[model samples]
Target: MFFFFVGGVEQQVRQVLKYGAGRCITCGSKADLVEYEKVLKAFFVPVWRWPGKEQLLHCNDCNLFFPPQLSADRTTTAVADQPDVLRCRFCKEAVEPEFRFCPFCGSSLS
Candidate 1:
């Protein structure tokens, strides 16, 4: 349906380095691999897409997966548009948006 734009993913990836290693989604590590799924719609049905259509992130430091950014950027126009994000007290992995608790280590933000 809607393309995020060519190499747009890379541009977004670059933003993370500026933010530094955020809270880890798994094990609450300072670094981690993030995994998530995405879907696209066409005529009211879901279609296969690239990258964000579904994905995983890998971290050399801690060897885990976690969500990336915790804060919204210039692109987001509304509070809702900002991802569901969390910060780990240790290791620093950014947790997923809809997680009830940390997916990596199962630590509760609650």
Candidate 2:
């Protein structure tokens, strides 16, 4: 008897706690406060999901994930102030100030 198995671990965004209007640390684009889940998949189907408690800073442009607590002051202030907001033409989502591209939809902001 022979058996074939495919398994992998995937990190998925569960929810957005807050949307920060600031530049991403990795790509200098927009980022958000996101809750994440770690999923275990086998044979292309999810077997288990582990939801995370703490919110993370996720960069839509570069796909960077880091603890928001690391930059709590900056992110909190940015979310509160929301200076120089720009809207994406394609997705109509809010873009970060001074960004050359829309982080949510990858559209040209210029």
Candidate 3:
């Protein structure tokens, strides 16, 4: 019975790591998962489901954690980011949300 419960909980944790809030960007196990906003010199930071709080790494024998590079790619594999629809902050023209600058005017969005 205990084993079954542990297995289920681990499965849920794995799913969260894959689809829910990010696991440790460094390691893949359960992270500190802190929630806070960041401000950096007029940079419009992308709002994540859970932000701030430094990412904590989980090592082997602690929690099964995947590397940041691999995990990040897998996490977004199932979903596509929304199209950009904000005007270029510098150029003042309609631009895709994902772009870093205005395609028409070539002004930096950041």
The number of the candidate with the highest lDDT is 2
> Is candidate 1 or 3 superior in lDDT?
1
Instruction: Give the Å error, residue 53, model 1.
Output: 4.3
Model 3 Cα lDDT, one tens digit per residue, 7-51: 111111212232333444333344432223333322333222323
Query: Over 4 Å off in model 3, which ranges?
Result: 1-85
Error of 2 at 32 (Å): 0.5
RMSD of each: 14.5, 9.1, 18.7
lDDT of 2 by residue, 1-110 (tens): 99998999887889888887344654556778899998999998999999977778888877777775443333354554754666665544567778998776476888
Candidate 1 Cα deviation (angstroms), residue 66: 2.1
Quality of model 1 by C-alpha lDDT: 0.43
Q: What lDDT score goes with residue 73 in model 1? A: 28
Candidate 2 TM-score over all chains jointly = 0.54
Ranking by lDDT: 2, 1, 3
> Which sections of candidate 2 miss by over 4 Å?
69-110
Q: Residue by residue across 1-110, what tens digits does model 1's lDDT show? A: 88653221120121123223444444433543343334455554546443443233445455444445532122334633545655444423466657667654567766
Model 3 compared with the native: what TM-score? 0.22
Error of 2 at 79 (Å): 23
By summed lDDT, the worst window of 10 consecutive residues in model 2 runs over: 69-78
